[model samples]
Target: MSERTRYEANVCVLLHRAGRWLLAVRSPGVAYAPGQVGLIGGHVEPVVGPDVFETTARREVAEETGLDLAGVDLHYLSSELYLGDAGQPVLTVTYMGELADGIEPRVAAPDELSAVGWWSLAELSTVENCAPWVPPLIADAERLLRRR
Candidate 1:
């Protein structure tokens, strides 16, 4: 049998005022379960002379959450590995960005996003069944908070 290729992607976890971080609830009807909160990001598309983070950050943010990155400061958060079916590995490059002008997350794609909102890092930590990928992301957020 031949080996399968692993996918690499970059993610941006948008944080808003009052220490609230953005989350997208995965829609239930899809292959993955619905109502699962996750950071906003997608694959890092190839572009001329573009770094992994720069190329995907703005586009991924627009795709996942309908918020624009105008004047927002994007900070490198952390990177972690996520598993796919058959134990395949996917690397997620995560970041934290503050809202520039008090805009909120809207449903850019209703089918893919059942709901979107901001929650405190503490609240997110307390979520009973947050996705397996969240703890590391939260740790990254805490680190960012400390530096502030």
Candidate 2:
């Protein structure tokens, strides 16, 4: 038998508005898929806390997009296995979140994120060359929104 593939837990945050959402442009130098547009999130650290999902979600948004969890209405969406190069799996726990007014993210960490901005679902559908796994995750989120 061949070596089993490895998977790591990650967090995904959906910042949504009136039928729109936020997407971040990943830095071009990251070992992972670089220069791809994706939801704001990252690996879930083991020490994140008892509420690991929430902690990681909050931390990820802060790290990548500078969005604090304050007043952000968040709901658990789904867990998905995202296949990257060499079939490496990033098992992501996703959340559907709505941001409150009077808050926005800047390029606080240039090394990790090149840019961040909001986009409508229709606009996202037309974004060329997004990370391969992102489209599926967005579809799932859209379905979840419809049910809500």
Q: After superposition, how far is residue 123 of candidate 1 from its true place, in Å?
A: 2.2
Count: clashes, candidate 2: 0
TM-score for each candidate, following the candidate numbering = 0.80, 0.83
Error of 1 at 144 (Å): 2.2
Predict model 1's lDDT versus the native. Answer: 0.71
| Per-residue error (Å), model 2, residue 135 | 3.4
- Residue-pair clashes per prediction, in order, are 1, 0
> How much is the lDDT of residue 59 in candidate 2?
84
Query: Which runs in model 2 stand beyond 4 Å of their true positions?
Result: 1-7, 82-89
In candidate 2, list every pair of residues with a backbone clash: none
Which candidate tops lDDT? 2
